[model samples]
Target chain A: MSRARNIEALKNILIVVLFLTTILLLYFLWENVTMKTFRLSSILPAGSSHSLRAEDVTRPEEIVFSFGAGGVTADPDVDGRYWELWMNAFQKYCGRGELLAEEISRAQFLQLTDYRAVFCRFAYDLPLESFCQQRGISNRGLNQIACVTEMGYSAGSPESVFLYDGRSGRCYRLVSELPAEGFEEIIRAAEQGEYLVYYGAASLFGAESSAVLPLNYSSTLAETPCGAELGGADDAERKAIAEQFFGADFGFVRRIEESQGSLIYMYGYDQKTLTFAADGSMVYREALNGEAGARRDYFEALQDALDFIENYGGWREEQGRHLQLRVRDAYEIESDRQKGYRFVFGVGLEGVPLYGGDGNLLTVEIYGRQVTAYRRCLPDGDLEKWKEDREKEAFSVVGLLSEGYPAIYEALRGEAPPPVPPEGEEAPQEGAFEWVAARLQNARPGLVRDAEREGSLRPAWVLCVDDCDFFYDLYSGEAFGAVPRQKD
Target chain B: MKKVIMALVLVLTLLCGSCFVCAASDPAVTVVNPQGNSTVYADNILISVKVTATRVLKITVFEEKLLNEDGSLSSLDSLEALGQVTAGSLRHVVVSPAETFYSNGNLSFYTKELKGITPGIYKLRVTTLDENGRTQYLQECYVVVRPPSEAKALSFQSEQSGVLSFLQSFLKNIFGN
Candidate 1:
C-alpha cells in the first residue's frame, strides 16, 4: 500500500510539472510572436553620427508686390528737356555718379494722355523708420505711402503744383520756395496722418518743383471752350445721342461753356446702369466719369493700367515716347454683376502712328457717354528721337530702383560687414576662418580632420570650413590648413 | 528510492529551464522592409512597413539609403547621388511612425513619379525588433523596373488633322454652330 501511494504521488507531480511547463511555453510563444509582428525599426537604415555644416544649407526669402496706376495724363512735352534738370539733381543727391545720366540719356520715354503712375516699394534689412527718414518722409497709419504731384506750366505764371495724397485722396497745392519748408511741413503732416502722398510732377527722387504736364488739357478743362466745334446742332439731339450711347439711365449732370466754341457735356450714370469698355486702353477717371460706388473700383482702373503695361505687348512699346501717339476711345460702365465701379478704354492698331512726324492731326470725340481721342503721326520727324529719349528716361528712374539696391545685392551673397573690435581692446589676431576652425575643433575633437578625403567626405569638410575658421582646400595638397595671418 | 526521486526532480528542472532559454532565443518580432529598395520617388516614396510581433512589435525607418556601386544598399549622408533633374529631381524618402505596436497600425511608402526612378533592380530591407530589444525579423524584396511613360505620343496624336476635324465637327454639333 505504501509503494502504491509513492507511485501515485510521483505521477501527480509529473503531471503538474508538465502542465506548468506547457503554460509557460505558450506565454513565451505569444510574447515572441507579438514582438516579431509589431517590430518596425528594420525599415529604415541607421542615421549618421555626423552633424550638418552651415555651408550645406541655405534659406531663401521670396517677395511679390501688387500695384495699380491711379490716374494718367498724356503730356506731349514730357521730354528729356523738362526732366533733365530734375534727373541731374537726383543723380547728384543720391551720389549715383554719371551712371544715371548715361542710362537716362539712352532711355525711351512716351507721352500719353491720362498717364498715372503707381509705385510699390519692397525692401529688406533696412528698418521702416530708417527708410522713411532717408526718403525725407514720415509714415502715418499704413505701412506704405503713395504720393502724386502734378505741375502745369503755362505761358505766364509759375508752374502750378498739385500734390495728391493717396491715403486721403485729397489734393494739396504745394507752396513753392527755396528750402521748401512748406513741402516739408506737408510731408510731416501727411506722415502723421499715415497718408500715402502721390507726387505726379516728376519722378519721386527728382526736384520737388519740376513736374511733368499732360499733353492734352482738354480733359482737364473746366468747361467746353467757346469756338470749339460742336458735332450736333441742338441740345435735344446731343442729349438724345448721349442717352442712346450711355444707356437710358445716363443723364447730363453739367455743361460748362468755355471761351472757345467748344461744347462740353458732363454725363452721369446710376451705379446699376453702366458698362465698361471692352479694351482697357483709356484712363480710369475718364471711365468713371459720374459713376459712383466703392473706391476699390476706381483703384481697379489703376490695376488695369498695370496689367496693360505688364501683359499688353503693344502698350509697353509705346510707353515713354513723345511723337508717335496712340489714343484710346473711353467707355464707362458698372462692373460685371456690380463688383463695384469699373471703366475701360480701347485703341485700334490703325489709330496708332508709327512715326510722330506724320502730318496726321488727332481728334477726340465724345459720343453719348463715351469719349475717344484720336491722333495722327507725322512722317519723317523728331517724334522717333523724342520717343527714344523719353523711354530712356523712364527706364533710368524706375527700372534700376526696382531690380535691387547695392545693399540688397550684398545681402543676397550672404556677405556681412566685419564685426567691430571691442572698445579699448586690440582686435583678435586670427581671421574669421581661423577663429571658426579653432572654435569647431574645440567643440568637436578631430571631427574636422578625420573625415574621408574624397566624395561624401569633401562636402563634410566644406561644411566644417563654412561653419568654422579652418580652411580646407579640396584642391591643394594642404588638407586642413589653418587660415594665414593677414598682412598689416 | 531517494536517489531516484532527486534525479527525477533535477531532470524536470533542467527541462523547464531549457524551455525558457529556447523561447528567449526565438525572435520575438519580424521587420518588413529595409534598404529602401522598394523603388519610390522623392515626393511619393515613404519608407514604412508592416511590423509583426510575437511579444510586441516596434518598427521604424531609422535611415535612408541610396544605390551604391555594387548595387547593394549603402548609407548616404546626402541625396547627391541621385543627380540633378533639369527641372528638379525627386529621390530618397524617409519616414517613421510615432508608436511601436503599430497595433497603432501599418505605414505606407508614397512616391510621386515612378519615371524618375532609374531602370535598375532595387531592394527594400526592413528590420523589426521586439519589446525585449531582440531582432525578430529582417525582410527584403526585389523591385523590377519598366520604361518611362511617353506623353509626347499622345501630344503628337492630338495634333493630327483627323483628330482636329473630329473635334471641330463634334464641337459644332454640340454648340449648334
Candidate 2:
C-alpha cells in the first residue's frame, strides 16, 4: 500500500513540473515577440530618410545694385598726366626704356613748375638754374632727391620724403628730421601756390592716388567709412510694426533704444526680439516653445517659412521700391542641439544683389510650419542712383585677382611665399576664379582725407578667397581690408 | 499526494523568482553621478556614467551654443568641435563578448575642469548596437559647465575661510585666551 501511494505521488509531482515548464516557455515566446515589435516600431521610422524639396530647387538670380564709383576720372586729369610722366621718366632713368639722358622736355619743365611738390629722379643733374629762369621761380639746386610730394608733403612730413635710386630701385628717406622753420616755410609756400622744390631724396617719386605700390599695403585701412543714415522707423513705428506683424498676442513689446544708433524691440511673452537698424536692416527672433505638433515635414516647413517671410518679413512686393529677394540657398540642418531648416535669401536691387555688411542679407529659420526666426539686413537708400553708379564701376574678375591677390596672400601668410598648385593641378587663371554672391563688401571706398577735408564715398569690390574676404578699391584695385567668413 | 502538492508549490515559486532575477539583469544605461546640472567648482569635473549592455558603448560629450547675438539658432562665432570621449576610441569595438559585454560598468571622466572651454549647454550621449542589429541610443542628458572664474572665486572664498579657521584653531590651542 505504501509503495503504490509513493509511486502515485511521484507521477503527480512530474505532471506539475511539466505544466510549469510549458507556462515558462509560453511566457518567453510572448516576451520575445512583444519586445521585437516594440524595437521594430521604434527603429523603422527613424531609419528611413526623407528628401527636402527645397534642396532640389535651383537658386534664383540675385538682384545686385550698383554702388557708385570713387574719385577716379573717366579721362586722365592733370595729376594723372603728371603721374604718367613720372612713371615714364623713372622707367627711362632706370634703363628699362630708352634713356632720356637727364634731358627735360620744354613741356615737362613747365608741368614740373606747376607741381606743388617736385621730386627729381637724378636731383644732382637737374637743370635747375635754367628751369627756374624760365619759370621765374627762385631756386635751390635740385639733385638726386627721393620721394617728395609737395601736395601730400605737409601731411607726409618733409623729413619723411623717400627717395628712390633709379639705377638700383632702392628707396631712401632723405632727412632724419626737417627743421621746424624750414617745414613751416614749405607749407606756407604750398598754401600760397608758390612752387616749393626741395632737392633732397624727398622729391624723386610722385605718389599717385590711384596707383598702389608693388606689394606694400594694409588691409585694415579699408572701412565702409561710416555709412550714411537712411532714415529708419522709430521706436513707435517699430513697436506698431512688430505688434501688427508678429501679432499683438506676443503680449508686450519693449523698446531698448539704440546706444549706438541702432534700435531693438523685445517682446515680453514668447521671447521674441526684433532689431532694427538706422540703415533699414531688421532682425527678428522667437522661441519654438513646444515640441509636439510644432514639427512639420521638411518641404512643408520651408514653404510655410517662405510664405511668412514674403508676407511679414519686409520682403513683400512694393512699387518703385526696386528691392527684391530670392532664395539663394536652402538646406536641412542638424547643428548642435537645434535640428531645423534654414533658408538664405540673396537681397537684390533690380536684378543685382548688393554684397556686403555681415554675410546674410536675409535668413529665415523654419523648424516646422512655424517660422521661428527671421533676419533681414537689406540696405535701404537711393537704390536707383546706387545701382546706376555701380554699373559704371563694376569690377572685373581679372582686375580683382591681379590687384587683390597679392595683398590677400600677404595678409594670410605674412612674409611666407604664397602657395602654387602642384604640377598636374589645373592652375587657377586670373579670371578663372569663382564669384560667390556675398553680403557686405569687405571694404568700403573712402577718400583719404586731410584734417580739414571730409572724404568722398568710394565704391569697393569684396573678393572672397578660401573663405576670407578681401575688399579691393574699384578705382585703384588696392585691397584695403579683409574679413574672415561669418561662418568661420 | 500531500507531499507532491507541497513540492509542486515550492517548484513553482522558485521558477517565478528565477524569472524576476533574469529580468533584473536586463541591459540599461544610466548616468550614476553628477546626474543633473553638474557644476565644475574645483580642479576638475568628474562624471561617472554607469552602463549595462551586451556590447561596447560609444560615449561622447558635446557642447551646444543655445543663442547668438543675432538671436539665430545657429551662430558661426560659436566653436563647433567640442566632443570629448571619457572612454573608448571613436570607432573602438571589443571583439570578445567576455571582454566587451558588461552588466554594469562605471566610466569616470576627469575633465580637468575643461579649462578654456566656454561656459554653455552641453550634452552626453551613449550609443550601442544590440544582437538584433538595432542601434540603440540612450536619452541624451544636458549639463551646464559654469563659468570657471565664478567657480574659482567660490573655491578661493572657501579656501580663505578654511585657512582662517585653521589659523583661529591654532591660536586657541596655543593661548586658550
lDDT of each: 0.26, 0.38
The CAPRI classification for model 2 reads as: incorrect
| Model 1 ranges off by over 4 Å | A1-337, A340-488, B1-119, B135-141, B145-177
Tell me the tens digit of each residue's lDDT in model 2 across A1-488.
99999999999999999999989788556433343222222223321432222332222121011001100011111122333333333222232211111222222322222222333221111122332333333322123322121111111222222233323223332222123123333323324442211111001111111111111122222222323222444454455556544564535667677777777778765477877765556777777755514445544565566556545533324435644444544555543355677776554444333444434556788775556678765554343334232223434433354334445556555653334444334433321111211111122232221111122223455454444556556556655556454331
* Cα lDDT of model 2 by residue, B1-177, tens digit: 765665555435433332112122213444533344444322223333443223455545555543434554321121122122111212221111111323332211111112244445455554554666455544444445554334321011122243454454345445532
> TM-score, B chain, candidate 1?
0.28
lDDT of 1 by residue, B113-170 (tens): 1213433333333445556676665543333232222101111112225445445434
User: What class would a CAPRI assessor give candidate 1's docking?
Assistant: incorrect
Off by over 4 Å in 2: A1-57, A60-230, A268-270, A292-299, A335-338, A387-396, A406-460, A467-469, A480-488, B1-177
The best candidate in terms of TM-score: 2
lDDT of 1 by residue, A458-485 (tens): 1011211211223222222133433211
List CA RMSD, all candidates: 45.4, 44.2
Cand. 2 TM to true fold:
0.33
Model 2 alpha-carbon miss at residue B102, Å = 75
TM-scores, each model vs. reference: 0.17, 0.33
Which candidate gets the maximum lDDT versus the true structure? 2
